[model samples]
Each structure stands twice: as C-alpha cells, then as structure tokens.
Target: MNKSRIFRTLLGIAIVSAVPTLAHAQKANWQNLDLKSDSTFGISTEKAYKELLKGKKSVKVIVAVNDGGVEATHEDLKRIMWVNTKEKPGNGKDDDKNGYIDDINGWNFIGGPKESVNFETLELTRLVRRDQARFANTTDANVAEKDKKDFEAFKAERAELEQKLAEAKENLAGITGFKTALDAVVQKIGKENPTAEDFKNFKPSTAIEGRIQGILIQQLEKGSFKDFYEDQIKEGLDYYTRQAEYNLNLDYDPRSIVGDDPNNDKERFYGNNDVAGPDAMHGTHVAGIIAADRTNKIGILGVADNVAIMGVRCTPNGDERDKDVANAIRYAVDNGAKVINMSFGKAYSWNKAVVNEAMKYAASKDVLIVQAAGNENKNIDVENNFPNHKDLDEKTIASWITVGASGPKDDETLKASFSNYGKNQVDVFAPGVQIYSTVPGSKYKSLDGTSMASPVVAGLAGLIRSYYPKLTAAQVKEIIVKSVTKVNHNVEYAKGEGPDAEKVSVPFSDLCISGGIVNAYNALKLAATYSGKSVAK
Candidate 1:
C-alpha cells in the first residue's frame, strides 16, 4: 500500500479472525482454560482457583475500569458493582466531598448534567483545529523560534487528517453501494435472514446474483452469515459514518457539554454522576472479563470473584480527551481503586503532560494502571499510542503494565495478527481474540481487540491483590511480568502491507517484554513465593 492508504487503514480498528481453523466445532473458552490439563492457550485461571485459592481467605480488591462506559446494572455485574458507601444515592449533594457529587457507582467525565457526548473528534483533528490558524502561514522567518516545532507538528497532523478524511468518504461510498445491492438480493430471496443452506440452494438467474451468492457462501464458510450482515457490516457502516461526520470534522467540538476548560490541567471535577453513559458495551465487556458473577450461572465466569468494579466513564465513542483521562485516573486513585484498567487509546495526545502527572499520582497512591497495547498490528516502539506509561523524559511508571493480545492455537501463529507488539513497550500478552464477555442489555458476545486483553491481565492483577493483600502495586506488576509462560519458537506472523501481506517466520519471544503469554496459575505461584505463602502440594 501507499503512504496515504497505510495512514487510512491505521486510522481504523484492526479486525482479525480469532479462530483461524476451518472446522465448525463448538468453540471452548480457551482463554480461561488450564493449560496444564486442557493443553490449550489459556491463562490457567481455573487451576489457580481450584488448587491455590481453595482454602484461602479472600480480600476485596477494587478495580477501576476507565473506558467508554459500563453497565453496572447488568445481571452479572450488579452485585459486584463498587458502591460508594460514603455517598448517598440521589441526594443532590457531595456526601463524601471527594470532589464529586453523588458518586454512588462512579463518575462520568464525558457527560453533562443531562446530556452525554457520544462522539468526538480525534486527537489529531483537534490538534489541527487548534493550531491551524496560528500555523497556517508559518515560515522560518515569520514564526518565532519557540513555536517552530509546534507549527511543524500541526502541519504534519493536518496533512494526515485531510488524507484520512478523504479515504473515509471514499470507503463509505463503496460500502453504501454494496449494501444497497445486497439488500436487493435479499429481497429477491424473500428472506430477511437467509441461512447458508438457503444461499446454496438458490438458483442464480443473473451474473450479479451468482456473484452475490458466491460472496455469501465464502463468508458463511468462516462464521454465521446473519452475524456478518447484521452485526459486522452494520457496525462498519456506523463506524465509517462517524469517522466522516465527527472524527475528521474540524468544526466538531463535543466538549461544550462538559463545560470545562479543555487545556487547563488544574481544573477538576466538572462532570455528572452518570458513570454508565450512552454506550457501555466496551466497558461492560472489560468489567465482565475482570469480575462477572461466577456462581450466577447466567453467563461466563470472570477471572476474579472478590473484585469490586468501579466504573469511571472517561472515554467516548471516539478518541478520549487527555483532560478526562487525567481526571479519571486521579478520581479512581482517590476513591480507593487499587487497579485501574484503561482499555481505550489513540495515536496522538494534545495534553500528555497532564496525563503523565495523573499517572504519577496513581503510582504514588499504590495504584497500578493496566493499559492496552493498541490493535494496529505495528510495533509501538516506532509508533505512538497515547495515555502510555512512558513519561516525557522516556522513563516508565513502575506501577503500569502494557498488555498485547494472543490467539488460541499455540503454534507458529500464536501471536494475534491484529495485536500491536513491542519488546520494550508492551509488557505481556493475553487472550484477546474472540473473547466472549458481557455486553449491554444483559447479553454476551464475542469481540476482538487488544482492548480485551488488557482486562484479562487486570483481572489477574486483582486476583493476586485479593489473595496477597500486602503486595505493592509495583510488586504485583513485577510478578505478572516475571511469571509469563515463555513461548520460545519461531511463529509465522503476518508481515508487509495490505493485499501483499505475507506470513513471515519470527521469534514470538521478541514481540513482548515478558517473551511469553500470561499464565494465571504461574502468576499465583510467583505471588505465593513473593509473599511466603504455602501452596497446595
């Protein structure tokens, strides 16, 4: 691909097949399986729960999920929702006086008194808008020496944003046309939801009909045709529409509802108490992966049982603001959150200094920040992902762990194709592809991204903190990083650009800092050794 096309593709989320196999067998939740007995790619949570935590006393550990939003009232999450005991519900007052009013569940920074901002511009777009007027005609002679660097950065971002906007418009037009034709074929078939057998048995009367039939058949061979049409395509259309209308629009400003100074770092506490904002699918899934009800028997079991999930709504559907992220971290830390799981990221940050200060504050309060290594399928060492652990001076925070995604099969294709990796930046790898977790409306579904992998590690961190209450945040991070199950072999990884991409053999260990996948059982053993606790023989 060319430079423009590469930038366009990277702007969107990377979607990869979770299960690369062709067989239509009932899939197992291999992410939670015990590798010792199941011989599958998993974190071994079952083994740790049955063997090590059988007779152990549990302690309540609070894990703050800082994402778009979380359905705290979901069937699997209601009982485990972190309640603010100090503050009374619906009293119209700050009962606890912790800089928030009526934070019974948590606080939402992206919403106002009555409305929530669902979509916002990307960081790059925001930067372009802010500096375009000042740097539009900047020259070496005209621009001040101090402002020359910022002017150059603004020019680069504006160029990239313009290219991405053009590509999004073109892609949206193509998909819209395709959807219209597919709807006509569906109408001709006289079935709103057609099965694979129906498509196979239908007699094509024209070349377009035959071509549509072939496409549907090929898609059905991978998974459900219904899901491919209703969920994937529909969501893709919405994503592209949003990208064109909101993400790339320089005139769009969703921060007016919050009614705060976006550039001010000292201003804090200016949002409403609606923690579970308009969309809660992503945050709800992350929360379920960490602490869904295990004994309810309604949905799948979460990794930890003694976890109180504190929902801090900071991220919107688009790129999250740096000011909100900084406040969210401080809010979680001040509200007794031991582990904060941040499942959202972007390519650029307008105010990284404030975020770094918040991270420093979290570390000072003994809070560990677990972040997702982005799903760009590119090394993060060369590319930039915002809200990271690295400070401006290139020093990393001690209580942070950056997680990458891993796949099911433990062979040459062990690493997830869509997962972003860096030996120095990403701390560990976990199961992220096709993770079945809780969604909105008390439902469960499978989603893929490094966003899913971050919570798996966060849940394990919560588990260790619950069992070993004396372990510091830094110690917990160290134990998780050091206890990874090393995969020392060459794997066929997807390389090169789009369409021309090919599988190339590379050592899996070089992808991440731990050089292995995370194992809950191994983490538990290491925790026991660190805390001097005896394990079951």
Candidate 2:
C-alpha cells in the first residue's frame, strides 16, 4: 500500500477528461495562497508572512525531511540546506565525530559502504522470506504455543502475497488487452494522435470498433488519444508490473548491500553520507514544500522563509525499514533538527520497538514530529499504519502531528479523494493535491498524496518555531491544532470506488480531530497568544 500510492500519476484527470486536463489540474503554489483571498482552500501562508511574521526577529530552525532522498543542490534548495559547519566537505573522517562521515547535509541509512538500495520488497514479502524457513513446512497444530502468533502472521502474509500476485497479474492482463485493442483501432485510423473530430468522421465497421470509438471520443473531448493511452494504460502497466517484479518478489533481496543486522535494533551508525540516494524525487519535493527558498526568484516560494532543511534519507521506493527510520530520527535530533517531516508510511512494520525508541528520543529533545496520515483512504483508527507516534508501551508522543490531505476547494473535494482520515488519529488537514515543488536534477513537478500534506504542516511548524522560539514542541502542536479554519458544511464522502462508490453526506467534523483545514494565518495568531509551556532556545 505504501509504494503503490507513492508514485501515483495524474493520468486519472487526462483519462476522464474530454480534452487534456493535466495542465488544468495543477495550480502553481496554491498551497501557500490565502483561501478567502484566492478562492482556494490553501494554508493562508502568504497572509501570515505579510501580517504577523514580516518584520519579526526570528532564529533559524532545522527541519529534517525523513523521506526517500532530497536534491540538496537544487537551485532554490541549495542555499537553505543544513550545512555541517563542524565537518570538512568530502573528507573521509567524521569531523564532528558523530559516527557519520562527511555528512554535509544529513545521513542516508539506505546506503552502505559501496552503494545504496533503490528497489526493495514490501514488508509482507520480507516477512515471507524470513519466516518461510521455519514455518513453511509446519501446519497450524504442529507449532509450539510461543511460536503460534508468528506462525499465524507468516501464514497470513503468505496468503496476502498470493492474492496480491494474482491481482497484479489479472490487472496487467486487462491493461495489455485494452492496449492491444486500442492499438488496432489507432492503426485503422492511420493517425498518430487522433482527436474527437477524427473519431466522429471515421465510421465504425464493427460493434467493437463502435464501442472503442465511443470511449476514445469521450477521452478525446478532453485529451488526445496519445494522452489517454499513455496516462491511463501505460501507467497501469508500470504499476502492476512493479508489483509483480519487485514489491511482491520473494526471491529478491537488497538488504545485504546495507550490511547491517536487521534483528539488532540496538545497532546504529552503519549508513553512508549520501543523503541524496538513487531516487531523490520524493524527498526533494517534500523539502521544497516545507521550505523552498522564499526569495530565490527562481521558483515557487515555500511555506516557510527562514529555515534550514536537514535531508535525512530513510524512505525509498518501498516501505522504509524500522531500524533505518529509528536511526534517521535520532540522527536528525542529535544534529540540531527541531522539526522532522516524515512523508512516507506503510501498513506494516518489521521492528516497531526500535522505531519507538527513536520516537521517544526525539520527544525528549523537544522535537516536533509531523507525519502523513497515508494515502490509503482508510481510517487509521480501524486500519493499520506504521511509524505512528504511539510507542511500544502505547504512550503517544506529545509533540506529534498526523496530517491528512485536503484539496484546493472547500466542497466535497476539500478532503482529497485518496486521503486517509480518522477523528481520533489524524490531527489536521492541509493542501496536498497537485502541489508544485522542487524535484531531483534541479527540476520541478506536481505530486499528490498525504506525503505532500505532511510537509505542509511541517513547514507551518517550522515557521511557528522560528518566530516563536520560546514555545515548546508541545505548545507548537497545540497552537497549530487549536488555530485551524473550521469547516461547517457537510462533504459528500465517497465510501468506495467507481459505480458502487456511495456518496455519503457527512459533516467535516467526522474526518479528523481538528474538524478543519490548517491555516497558517490562524496558527500564527494563536502561537503569539499561546504561552502555557515555554522553552529557551
């Protein structure tokens, strides 16, 4: 569920549109605009900066982006990257003696002494590979009492993998058949890219041809045949193919490259200094959303202006390891990061104990942790999501914010179509749909998911911390939570997908704890007045 939603495309817009709606779906820097002023459901970031934080003296705050990897050298991002003044650049030694060598920006646990891991099997697949040795040959009655839970879990994982593989293959077959049919019709049309007019002018000789023409004509009304084929069909092929080839592949193992003991949660300090790993796109976009250079005059302005981005590369194309995530959190806190942004999550965990220890460590340091509520569209209160603030002892972190995605409108689409929500679990909602930000290679692109939503809250957290340096991490969370723009209307919540998708009119209060979307203008106003618990910076 984690990696499957990470690289989701905007092809859904192009596929259903009458002409191409891809360009229309994107609104540049809409997340930072004022909702009332701009008629978009944004964070009102610009209003806060102009009214509350414009001339205020502030201190620099480091916000760690704990995700795939970040493009630190991006045109707008390079100047604001957290530089390790204690370490000498490109040297072989740990100048600061922090265990990590030459960590100019941050650390990458995904990397080892030689190279980094790009593709990894899902946690279910990893569990299968590990537990299959002991439980594969055993039956329900043959297992010992102590090993019963593990044996049952192994069985469940194996069954899930089988089902996933079957579904992937079935979806792949459907897409392939559709592509074959589409190609045949395109060949008959004799046009590289057909339009609605072309489809209407050419008469269908057969029933299948007529059906194909009808479908293609609806698509061409908003997009071209090329757009429909590439966005809808090819994207599906890639997704299902990846599920079969890498994510669900039990034989594939990429952990040996890291050369660390997966069972040893006590083991730390075993990764390389290459924060920008093989895939920096996700993390780079996350960093930009949090604090892209505000005055760069090169690209879009980030939510926060004066802040340092600490790139802690932990997440990859797949579910992040708990050991790596724990280490990443400790490293960021130890390296002077006051706020950490986690944009990736999964439904399973390999080792929650280590991750719990790291969360406690971060909490002790008064660092606010902000994480996405995931893109699964399932309520976390009923479903499972890993790396949550709750520890092994069931004690939740005091300075944690769980964010859900909201769109650019205050209507039914206000809550993003794919956002996960819970009245008790999720803290607030933020702009996450088609958010434009810095990508790898000094480029930029718009991406969707709660991954984008977490950074928006993280940016606002950084902004508050920078301006109100005396506020504790808990107080910062309090201000952000108590100062939201309340929504008082009923949203037509779709319970399922497609024709069977029932649109239930539910009050926005049932979505998340805050019962509203995040507003920087309101949060800053509350932060200025909030002084219950104070800390010296």
Candidate 3:
C-alpha cells in the first residue's frame, strides 16, 4: 500500500476514535422549559415567569459575569448590559475614579490598552517557576523545615508540567499528521468539500483505501467530513499546539502585558476598560444564561429578566490568576453587582488567601457568589477546586453557592458524567448538559460543563434578588439551597475518566449538599415566604 493511503487509513481511525458517542436519548431544550409541567429537568423558570411573577414588582439587579469576556454588543445582551453612568464613554479618562479608564460597561483584568492575554500558563506552572530559586538546588539536608511543603509542591508541579508538555507534543503531532493526510485525501478526491456519497461511490482497490472509506462513512453518519476534519480536527490541533507552546512552557510569561503585580492583592486597580476582550464566547454564554433580553423575541429568554449584566473579564483560556480574581470580585462589589457569577475554577490555587479575602469582601457587601463545582468528575470533598466557599480553617462562606451539573434525565445518569460532585463542597445541582445559551456575535450554542451550571444558579440568585429586594445574599443562598427539588434515586456515578469510563451506581442525593437540583419556582416561593411577600398565584 502507498504511504499516503496508509496515512489516510490511520487518519480515519484517529478521527473516528476522537468523535464522541451520541447519547441514546434525544436532545431536548429541557434547561429552558418548565420542569414541573414539561417533565424535564429544568429550574422551572418558565413556570415562575408565567404563573408567579405576573404582577410582582421587580427591582433591577446587577450581575457580574467574571469570566473570559462578554459580548456587550450582542443583540440579546446589549440592552441589558450595565453601563457605568458616572464614567464618560469614549473619553480617555477615569471619570468615575474607580481606577479603570473608560469602563463604561465593566473592566477587563486580563488585558491592556493594546493587547489581551488569552492563553496563559497554569497556576501550577507559575508556582513552580516562582519558587525555583528556593527549591531548585535544595535537598532534604539544606531545605528548611518550613519550606518542606513548598519544596514538595514544587517537585510535584514540575513533574506535572513535564508530563503535560510531552503529552501535548504527542497530541499535536498526531492531530497535525491526521490533518495532512485528510488534506491529501481531499486533493486526490478533487473536491473542496467531499460528501459521504462521494467517498462511498469512489472505488478503492487497495486495503488501506477500503479502510479509509469505511471510516469516512462511519464519521459521515454523525457529521459531514468537511466539518469533522476542517473544523473539529483543526481546532484540536490548534488547542494542543497552544498547550505545548504556552500552558506547559515554564519560561512563557504572558502576564507582563497586563503589567500588574500578580502577587500584590492590594494593587486592585490596574486593568484596562475593554470588558469584552478578544474572546467572549464563554462569558457571553454565561451572561446570556443569566440575563439575555426576554422581550426582544430574538434569542432564548434568560433566567432573570430584570438584570443588568456587568462584565468583569478576568478568566482566560487557561487558569485565572488569584490576584485578578480577587480584584474582579472587589470591582463587582464596589460597582453595585448584587450577584457575581464565576463560571471558572482550577485545581491549584497559588494564592488562596487573597481570593478568600476578596470573597469575604463580597460577602461583607452582601453580594451573592455562585461558582462552578468544576467538571473533573471527582468528589471535591476530598480533592480541592479553587475559589471554593470553605476557608482555610474549614468555615464556609455564607454568600457562596457551588453548583454541579445535572442532566435532563431523572434516571441513573441524573448527574452529568463530567460534573464534579460533593456532599459537602458542592451546594446544589443545576441544568448544564447541552445548555443552549447565547454565544459571541449573537449566536447561540449548546455547551456542556459545570461552567454552564454555575450561571444557572447565578441567574436564580439574580431572579430572587430582583423580586425580593429585602433578602440578603446569605438569605438568597439559603433559599436556593433549601428549595431544591430533592432527587433520592440512584445515579450512575462516573468511576473513571473519559466518556466511556465505567459507571457505578450511587444515590443522586449523595452527590451534593442539597441532595437535589435547583428549582426556580420553588426558590421563588421560598423567597416570597421568607420575605413575607405575596406572589401572583
């Protein structure tokens, strides 16, 4: 067989293996529909808006979406964006004197006047780099007793970076080779966009060609060959390449562009005014889930109609810095954001103290913070995910609620396979699997992750605060946790890693603190009762 034909066969096998298996159940827009009436696993926001909130007076609530960035000009999001009235738009001045210049919408902590930091080194990599002098040459004899833990951490992180770098290089090579082979096939076929029929009709005399044909036919059943190879494969190759070049590169320093002391948490006011930075897909999806325009009839309705989304861009494609996260929290709190949605988390936290202090500040200001419980599929009670509600001494933050993703089905796979669960760490479950929300440029997509789940809870908090203005952030957190729809049935818990990992039967209630999924109607009812207010029946 020819070398090109063999490569094509290998490429076909690689592509087929990479494709995710389709779920047996049909896809449903269950996240937006009423759970009670529609028999879907939703928060019942539709029912709440239709039945309970008919004549209720709503107060405008500002929600801070502290993620990558947000599309302030998005058709469904523009009208509902929180504008800094005190600051002058288009004028190069810190009119509000809040330190950020021209921050008419919000602020971007990961960008500067001329540049934006999209991909960055992980926290672990940074930590290893920072402590290189102290731990690099020190052995057990020379290492100080107090520095023992730091030394151990440094060693572990170094090993992790080395392993990750090797893996990323391997992945990049494989993806690049596959793409080249795919391009060769396309050229040989003499089609810019080859279809399944074309591949099927083409007579393959060689064994390798026959194998390639079979693989293409299999993939075409799921999606078009052009889409699979051009879009998905290209994206994978780019991601792996970036991971090898930036994320695992110990010498890489993308933070210098921001020009802020990352170690100094007190240096809070140093980021640019471009809230919607280079990438806003993640943040826009999160913001739309919380407060998309409801009356526009253009996109899907948001969880809270009377909300003004404030974009405080901090998170990047890689893990967010603790200093930026802390500053983002303070900015949101100072700018009158009652609810802060953090749809991001990382395994390691280099400066947990600073982030905790910021969380305390938000708590003091009575601002509710909803964080994703992470998508690692691990029990977070044992393993840690950063920016959690718990303090170093194990005291929980009153204003914080960590959310896990829940699927549409109420059966064995009730909890999302990728969702991180914990009876202690994770507060509640929410609709996150295949959640349809607005992305960048006014487009809508169904993305899965606990990142999506956190915003669902954040939107609920926004809704509760909007109707019941008297309730404190702590009270809102309590209402959300206390009003979830309890699910006592057993669920198929993820036993290992990946989609095809073995699943073990575990009770759904054991997955989270609330032992239930968040319900908007129940939360609203609880809010009304707690505040001694009447709702429209």
Candidate 4:
C-alpha cells in the first residue's frame, strides 16, 4: 500500500475505535455521565469540592470579577462576599487610601463615581473625530490614504452601530408589547405579586398574552425576579432604551457624562467606587458563579465556595475599554486577588500596551487571569481579540488562560456554535452551554459563552489555590492543563442551520496547547504532586 492509502487506513482505524490510553480511559469514565441527571457528576466540580475542602477550612481566595458589578447581597452570595471594612459606606472618605473613596467592594469604571458613560461610543467618537480632522478635503496623498482607511473603518463601525440599534429597537418593542400584556394579566390574576404557578393559573385571552406568558416563563427561569417584574421590567426597559440611544448611536458621547478625557490615555485617575453601577445584572451573576454560598439550597451553587468575588465594574452592554480592563486587573492583583475572571472582550483594542502592561503586572504578582475567548466562533489566530496578552509577536506574557465554550454532549459537535477557537490563542475548553448560574438582583439565569467557561476554570483555580496555598500561579496552570482529558473524536461542529453541514473535528492536539478539557478532580490530584503534599483520597 502507498503512503496516502496507509495514512487513510490508520485514520479510519483511529476514528472507528478511539485510541484508549490510560488517561483516555480515565477521561472516558467522566464522559459516560448522563448529563440530564440531577446528581450528575461534574468531574471538575466534585473533585475540587472534595479535595480542596477536605477539612472545611475557611480559605478566602479572592477572584476579581472584572466585567460588570455583582449584586453583593444576593441570598446565596451575601455570606461569601468580601466586604471592605476599611471604607465606611456613604461616608465619602478614602479610608483604605487606595485612591477611590468609599470603595466598599470594588469600583465601577463605566459609571465612575458621579456619572455614567458608554465607552464603546466614546471610541467611535474618537475615530470619527480623527477621520473628520484628517479627511476634510485637503487632497494630500499620504494623509488622504490614512484618512480614507480610517473613514472606512469608521463607516463599518457606524453601520454596525445602526444595525445593532435597529435590532435592539425591535427587541424592545417586543419586550414592551409583552410587558404591557404582562401588566394587565398580573393585575387581573396575581394582584401585586405573581409566582410561576400563579402565572400558569392566570388565563390569557389575546395573542399578546401568550407572548407575555413566554416572557414570564423566562423571568421565572432566572430563578427569582418574578415578584419584582414591575421594577425589573422597568429597569430592563430603561437599560435597553439607553443602549439603543447612546451606545448604538455613532454620534452620542457618554464620556462627557463621566467627566474624563477618554482620548487621553494618561488621564486615568478618574473612576470611583460605585462598583454596582446602574446595571448590576452581569456582574452580580458572575459574582454568584464564583462565590455564592454553597449548601444554601436557596438558588444555585457557585463554583468556589471559599472565593471572595470582588466586583470591579468596567464593562457596559458594549465593549470594555482597554484602559479600564488594564486598570481593573492591576487593582485586583494589587488588592490581593489570586485569580481574576474577565468575562468580557472585544475584537478591537486601541491601546494594547496598557492592557499588556497590566497583564505583566498580574503575572509578576503570581496572579492568574482567566478570560472569555469570544463568542464569534471564528478562528482567533486570524482575528485578534482585545484584553488579551497576545501581541503581533504571537506570544502570551503569563498565566493568562483563554477559554472556549463546551456543551454537555461530550462530543466535538456539542461545542457551542458561537465559541471562538484557535490552536494558539485559546488555551482550553470548558462547560459553557446553557449554564445555570447566578445573575443579578438575587436571581439566577442560564447563559452560554466562554464567559461562563472562564469562571468555571477560575473556580477550579481557586480550588487548587485553596488546598495548596504554597503552589505558585504557574504550578496551578500546569496542573489544570496537564489534568485535562484530550480526545481525537471525529465530532460535530457548529450546530444548527443547514444540510451542506460543515463538520470539523480538530485532532486532540489542535484544540489547544495542552490538548485537553479542564478537569478539576485531576487538577487537585496533580496539585498535590506539585506542592509535595500527599494526595488525599
């Protein structure tokens, strides 16, 4: 047989019967789990909880939540939160001497201390301003060439903004319609407060009522926020309205609302201590995921029971500024956070140096930063995502782990269709599909993305750090990477849509550097070796 035929034969054999190495068999046992079962074993979660908390020792590992502000007082989260006792509430003094006054937990970069801003629109405004100044019909060849490129980029952004605004408007209209129908139904059947069972019993006459039922069901799935739809609905309506108006408009500038010269990267000492900004949904949800009190049986269990979720609100409904992300990482590391979870990212970054500098600083402090790979599902090695450590040099600076989304189906096809991937860019994959975790205002919701995946890994990182406090950041990274289960399964890719059916399965080697899926149980077992400690059970 020729070489090509021999290779084909080998490939066929490999696909037909998996090459079961010892590690593969161990991982295979984990893959056999019935994901639909209530007591379904999450190898990572179970192992971490058991090994890391053997004696139930109180280990407070702070995980900085850098996207949005978290709800500090959720029923399941209140007990585990890290409160800044040095800074007295509403006293207007910088008691901790950490620059920001009254920072009881963390700072809100978007809202600043006094005002709010839409940072993405601010970047757009800057681009527009540059285009206007450079392209005002001077007819200089070189300058005109630069201006033309800038103008095209600006135009693309403007188009995107307009399209997003239009979509938001349509969504808001539907929400408004359903909300109107919901108000009438709740008033008639539920009086002031309505439960899921109450809404089920409530009758609907018009087509709008059916839509209202769907909306109510969605709110119910969020776990709570049923009794406060009047407040939650209004708040949501207002948020979407603002997003459509300011964030979606190419001309609008919310930077002025925050009183900072956004174009000047040097003017950084602005934002204040209002971590829980006008919108607390994403931050609160993230906080609950990392550190919600375990064994509460009230809402949901967080990944790390011993973690202190520090909410540094820097992201809005749109893109997070590089400056805010960099500063937030620095703050988290400096303030004693061992692991920082950045669940938000964008395709463009203006000042890459600022973010890179912060990443380096975090590395020096032995801090591990977990980032969301992205939601675009495109190969990231070709396209760049911001708040990343990678530069044109094609190298990551430190213990920065970029995570992709994984579905419950233990097959390559189960990967979330929107997850971004790259052999060099993304570090690993984690459970990110339809994850039931914490949200804001004492609620829980099912969200999907590498955003969810990053926290899961962060929880695992916290577990490793909790049990083996002596292990370094790099050691934890090695343990997690080495413990992952790698497979060469010929699985499905990008679900839904058509029959031409694009199916691609990466060789286990191509998915990430470690070629593995994160497993918390094995990480702890490995951490024991790294720390020179005996493996416990």
The RMSD of every model to the true structure, in order and in angstroms, is 4.2, 3.3, 5.4, 10.7
TM-score of each: 0.93, 0.92, 0.91, 0.75
Error of 2 at 198 (Å): 4.0
Task: Itemize residue pairs with steric clashes in candidate 2.
Answer: 18-221, 18-222, 19-221, 19-222, 19-223, 20-222
Overall local distance difference test of candidate 1: 0.82
Best candidate per TM-score, number?
1
The predicted structure with the larger TM-score, 1 or 4, is 1
Rank list by TM-score: 1, 2, 3, 4
- Residue 151 C-alpha lDDT in model 1: 78
Query: Which of the two candidates, 1 or 3, achieves a greater TM-score against the reference?
Result: 1
Give per-residue CA lDDT, model 3, range 65-182, as digits (tens): 9999999999999999999999888889988888888998899999875888888887777877887866768987888888999788888878888897887787778778667656
Query: For model 2, how does the per-residue alpha-carbon lDDT over 258-282 read when each residue is reduced to its tens digit?
Result: 8988778888888788889998988
lDDT of 1 by residue, 226-265 (tens): 6767554566567678889999999899898888888787
Candidate 1 Cα misplacement greater than 4 A, ranges? 1-28, 137-146, 203-208, 392-396, 532-537
In lDDT terms, which candidate is top? 2
Candidate 4 Cα lDDT to native: 0.65
